[model samples]
Target: MARWESGAVEPDMATQAAMATIFHVPAERLSALLWPNWLPMGELFHVEGVWSPENCHSLLDASGDLMLERRGFVTLAAGSAAVLVREWQSVGRAVPEFLSGTSEDIALGFEGRLPWLRDLEDAHGGGRVRRFVDLELQYANELLRQTGHGGAGGRRLFRVVADLCRIAGWASADTGHLAAAERYFVLGLRAARAGGDRLSGANLLKCMTLLLAEAGRPQDALLLARSAVDATADGPPRVRAMLTVRQARVHAILGERDACERLLGQAETAMAETDGQPCPDWALYFDDAEYAAQVAACHLALGNYAVSDHLLERTTRLQPASRQRDGVTYGLWWAENAFRLGEPERAAAHLSETVPLIESGFSTRNRTRFAQVRRLLHPHRTLPQVRDLDARAASLLAWGA
Candidate 1:
């Protein structure tokens, strides 16, 4: 054990299996995952406790320690993820206890800064904005500790903290801190529940679903997506549409074409039902362009490369100029699809176009995706276009480093 902890020796498969048994992890999961990847490191899946302000505070405190741990990405096992979602759904709705306090103005102040922070993240990328986001989260935590969860102000404060958690989680995920992201999401969900903000809670679940899907846990992602949809049965039409599209993306990943198309159609129908009624501030980002991009992603997952490419072009053009990170992301996706479509030259050209944008910004997620594309193009490295792309990508990687 000492040798394993010091990295001098790894636990053999038998030792790992025994450790898994002690940790309550399933044997099959241990076999499926690499050595330490099977270990359950966070309390996100520990659904044994009751949902309350105290529990939320405890989680928030633990999350601060989690932020300092730079361990690599680790996702919940499919069974564990399913259990977590079920526990989340079964927890009683917590209402903020009203006490003598005046924090409404303070909560509003935090709320006002959210849009600017979000814009910075979207424009510059998560690596640039993550520290700022983490600072905001810490501030929110301080407020929670000082204010004592009660009063109308307390409820509003919880909502603000939940928003901060969502942003922090997203930034962490973008910067390749997946463990921190998952913890933040769980804490945010608890905060949202404490504040009775169903919409925000649903959003957190949606974010978690996407995160799991990106981590190659589509089955777990699908479960969470379904739970989000069910929980938001009476939510705004646009929000419902957004969640449905996300579920469709997971279905596409799982190669369930018919289910994916059916969900996509449902999402479109929900969008048509939206009469521009004021949606939640968070849901407003799922506009026409965003919707098209999500649909394109679903198609990409389903292997409809040509259709995905067409929609991606439109999506990129429709994106706001300030959303440079998003533009670069879509451009990368386009390149991946091109490669999948057997057009290495086109793929190389697309990848070359994104290099300048990537060098100018900072997104670990985008950089990771860029690496994936480079690997895809490696076999044709001798080609002229591929050679040019290699040179450009090499410089971008050095800049990132």
Candidate 2:
């Protein structure tokens, strides 16, 4: 072992195979670790009808970078990354295997269920939607692994799968499962690339940025947000605006007021340019109320309590019925800011109003945010309204249990 470690000797093929078997890893993986330079090109990855050797090499290089940044955020694009273009070009050639379902039927099915599923997510929470989406993803992946479909049908199917994965990832993040969220985002990106959907991949990166930003790694979040923007530089106006909002959020986290406001203005401009252009299904939800919420979050982060309060009020009033999660979330923020501005009674009232929705099993984000509000109001626990609000929140939070 010492001699092998010192590079005085190399393991024979038989020994390498034995080592791989013992370690429960593929022989190719073992070889790459031991004699990487000595192995030929095709030997790098022994498996696959999916990715070419070049693609595998790119992914392998990316895995190294991801490992280094494991605790922080990892950018989706790898070295020499024209990932979307490459995946687009390689689509027909990469996998000749046929999938079972007609892409049209699958598409129709997805469309029929999407609205209901989204509403469920809003009303119930990520916990309710995640398992359902996860199962769909699993089935879609299995279909891709089969033989029978190819060409445009295959690409269409892949895109649908990608979209489902994106939704699943979003749900996971809503539940505060950041690690699971990252895995789904990565998988979703691969499926998006395979479908030649650059916009979808860019959106997944944006999701990652949001996840990292909320997890408190602002530097990493800023880098990922920039990557999302660069990836979709010339994409749809609404899509660009969506990504720009995330970038603005990151800037806010980093305390860059000027940069945040600049990007927010750019987002507003992009939204205006969207005009009559067909918005992607994924971006249809980026409405005025949502934009207002994003702005409020930025200002709230930057200590502009009064401005944020005005925006939050407008947002909750705009579409309270449609945006269940947003209404509850903005309500929590309003309460927090109210207390910050030395209005404990207003804060208690705001919290009181939002508590019923919080008990609706919507998202951990609302619950978590409310907990922070609770902490903020703790110092004023002697106040009757504050005491009542605390009891109500605690009871709501412990309802199912």
- Top-lDDT candidate index: 1
The C-alpha stretches of model 2 lying farther than 4 A from their native spots are 1-106, 147-150, 396-401
How do the residues 211-236 of candidate 2 rate in per-residue lDDT, one tens digit apiece? Answer: 76775567766776787777766777
Off by over 4 Å in 1: 1-45, 75-78, 91-105, 397-401
Output the TM-score of candidate 1. Answer: 0.85
Clash pairs detected, candidate 2: 98-147, 98-148, 98-149, 99-149, 125-362
Which lDDT values do the candidates have, in the order given?
0.79, 0.67
Clashes of each: 3, 5
Error of 1 at 310 (Å): 1.3
- In model 1, how many backbone clashes occur? 3
Q: Could you tell me which 10 consecutive residues in candidate 1 have the lowest summed lDDT?
A: 92-101
Whole-model alpha-carbon lDDT for candidate 2: 0.67
lDDT of 1 by residue, 222-297 (tens): 9889988887777779989999999999999999999999999999999998786667777878887788899999
